[model samples]
Each structure stands twice: as structure tokens, then as C-alpha cells.
Target: MRRWAMQAGLCLALCAGAASAAPAPTWRGLDPDNTLVIDTSQGRIVVEMRPEFAPQSVARVKLLAREGVYDGLLFHRVIDRFVDQTGNPNNRDGGTSSHPNLPPEFDFLLKPDAADAIASRASDGITGFVGATPFSASQLPRPDGTLRAAGAYCAGVVGMGREEDPGTGNSEIFFMREPSRRLDRSYSVWGRVVQGLDVVRTVAIGEPPAHPDRMIKVRVMADLPATERPKLEVMNPRSAAFAALIRKVRAAKGADFSICDIDVPSRSQP
Candidate 1:
């Protein structure tokens, strides 16, 4: 049985009632432009894209969304504790897109004080949000004692899965279901699941789910019909409010704090 089904069964056994209502919305630092609304069979999953860190990947996702390439695709590959991947028109192995393949954007320089906010003792690196997307950074000091950093991978991150060639990532994207620090330098980190994480956790698990879930519809928030569009607010990682949240979380977790522990806050409205 799928993890989601098992969990749902557990909920039914324990609660003996309908699922509880969702929490009230808490609007924070809103990024209206970069959000993507994905309606899947399970539920709606909202992703906030980061062009600053992975401009090409963001551009590719936007283009695919606008062109309607992602609609009706299966969550072809989903492993319980690792990731759930899709966006292959050929199902799992044979899909291709008219869009050109992109070179890897594995690492980039940190913008401003992002370095100070998510100082990661777990990986000897740093982690923080650029817009609503959470990222970790690996660094080594130069001869002049200046540190150069690259993005790190954590849970909720959406990354490109590639073939043998590092530059072949065109349309295959996956959601990180758990923290796989080993992928930090390998895959290109592009966006994050800001809302509907519970839905993500329920995706059918298998290399190919026996009954795979599909993305019913995918839209860039900008492209949605005006009345149908969702208003989303995500805490700006670079803001004082987010800084305070980070401090509070660090204090609470202490030695147990990992970048994956933080889920950048976001709220959505129809």
C-alpha cells in the first residue's frame, strides 16, 4: 500500500472522524510573481521559483508551464523517502521536449546577508531562502580569505534529474521528500514546495507508482485567469521577519537543527 493510503488509514483508525480543517491563513512576505500552482490528483502543490539562483531552470519551468508541457504527466518515479519525479512526456525514459537542454547551474554566489541567516553547522556550509525557496550553500575560503559559495539541496527543493551528461536536464523535475545532502553538488536546485506539502507526502511511492498520481493542471500564477488565480504570501528570506523566525527555530532545535527543519512559510487564497 502507498504511504499516503497507510497514513490515511491510520488517521481514520485513530480519529474516527473527518479530516480536520486546514489552519487559518498566515500571510507573510509575499512573492506574487514567481509562484506556480500545480493541481494534482491528490491536491494543490504550490511552488515558489528562484530565478536568482537557477535562472535557466526557472526559465525552463516557466516556459513549460506557459506552453502547457507539464499537464497530464504522471509522477512516474516516486520513492518513499527520497523524491518524486515527473515531467517526462514519454512517461519515464522516452520523453523529450522541443525546448533546448540546459547546462547545469549547480552552484552560485550568495546574495548579500543570506550567508548569515542559514549558517549550517550540519554540513559545514550555510543555508537560507532566496525568495521563498530554501537552499544550502557550500564554501571554501580563497587565498584572500574570502568565501565562495554554491547552493545546497534539502527537502521540498525541486531539482532537475539528468542523464549521464551533466548538461542534459531539460524537462525532468523532482521534489525532494527528504534531505539528501549528497545531491547538493549534483542536481540543479530551482524551486520549492511552499504549500500543499501534505499532498506531496501522499504521492504514490514506487519507481513507477502502481497507480501513479498525475499533475491535473499546471499553471504559472501569472498565466492563470484573473478570477481563478491564487494570492500567495511567502516569508521573504532576506527580511527581518524571516531572520527572527530563523533565530527562533535555531534556538528551539539547537544541535538538531538542519536546513530541512525549516519550511519557508507561505499562504494561498483563491
Candidate 2:
């Protein structure tokens, strides 16, 4: 009984160590082509869409935004502490662009030539960062030696929506207000909010908000006039400082460490 108690105490201590908060991160400029600006009833939210993981989804979103298809779209479906969903042209639950539905890019295969900074590894899989986005992937190789992985659905993640078939997803999108484990791999995460998360959280919450907030204007950074452009940046997770950050977080979290716990540092200037 005494030995059992001692082991339990030790386990508790280790778990406590694994839950500690990490220090802040360093920063770098964002690529304008990959950046998007959304002005909503709540305020402005800027997202950095990743083409490396979901090129077609990113392209579709970019096409819709540049063409003013998203302007005045309602935050049609919102659920508190979950997601702020919108981009349905009809301002109802279901709508899509004239474009054909897209196949899911729920997870992508990482070739050896891919750029990534691993945070943790196990026999079967690894968790790490790929351009400020956290990802979990298998360590086992495919026939081509590439690894399969999906993004960690942390807060502020932007994902496309589909009602029935995964392929039905087109212009609709949603933003994470909190970490959603179940949504990972079920939805394609194409981008994350680098700034204005507070605004995102403030959006009216309801299955269909009683007074739903609407996107006043949405644009790809490249389409915005120079004067209207907002500059955004994220701390490079692949850098030496980020390596220091990983060590600090890992030491603090111990066995509890997860890539989802690392908040990629960012800044925005309007």
C-alpha cells in the first residue's frame, strides 16, 4: 500500500509539471500572398492561409474573397466555445458557390523534402510545427516514404465546412473559438488567425445567432490597396529562439506536452 501511494504521488507530480505555461515567442513578417483580411461586425480578423497543406481549398477561398463573394455574408451558424461559421451566401445553414465541390485535404503527406520542426516523437508518430501551424503525423513511412499528418485544431484555426459528403465543401468556412479535438481530420484546416482573435470570440453565439454578425468586407491581402493593407507576422517556430521555446515548454509540461499547447506568437499592424 505504501509503495502504491508513493507511485501515485510521483505520477501526480509529473502531471503537474507537464501543465506549466510556456514563455512568449519571437516574430517575423508574413507573406502577403498568403494573408487574408476580414472586417466583421465584431472587428477585424486576419488569417494566414497555408497553401502547402491545402492548396485547392486555399485557392478556392482566395478566389471567393477576391471576387467579393464573402462580403456581407452572415455568421450563419455559430456555437459558443466552438466555432464561428459563415461564408454561406444565402445567410442560412446551406449554400455554396457555383464552383464544383472540392475533395477533402483533411491530412497531407509530408515528403522528406518538406519543411517541419518536430517537437515530440514516439514510435508511431510525431507532433510538430509546419510554418506556425501545429501538426501530428505518423512516423511510419508510406510506399514513397512520405508520412501522413493533419493539423492540430487549436483556437483560431479556419476550416472549410461540408454538410454531408466531405467533397461537398466549397465556399463555406468556420473559425475555431476553442480547441476542438474531434474536428481534426474531419475538416480541412487551411489557415489560422494571427490577429483579432478577441474579435472572433465576440461574434454573436447561437446555432444561428439571433442577431448574427456579418462579414462587412473580406479580401486577400494582395487585393487590398497598399494603404488598406494590414501587416501581420508570426514567430518562426523553426528558428533557434523557437527551439529554446520548445525546450522551455517541454520542460514545463513534461509528459503532458502537446503541440496544441504551444501558442504561435504573432503581431498585426493596420
Quote model 1's TM-score.
0.80
lDDT digits (tens) for residues 88-198 of candidate 2: 888877798988899998999875445346788776677777677777887665655566888789888889998878888899999999888788899888988888889
What is the C-alpha local distance difference test score of candidate 2? 0.81
The Cα error of candidate 1 at residue 254, in Å, is 2.1
lDDT of 1 by residue, 1-270 (tens): 454454344334322211235422234543546778899999998887877778898889888888899999999999887898998888795476898889998876653333324435333544655555666644333333323454556778888878878899899898888778798868888878888877888999987889999998988887777787666666555455666677888889998887677767765543
Residue 97, model 2: lDDT of: 91
Instruction: Give candidate 2's TM-score.
Output: 0.86
Computed on alpha carbons, the lDDT of every model, listed in order, comes to: 0.72, 0.81
Q: List the residue pairs that clash in candidate 2.
A: 18-253
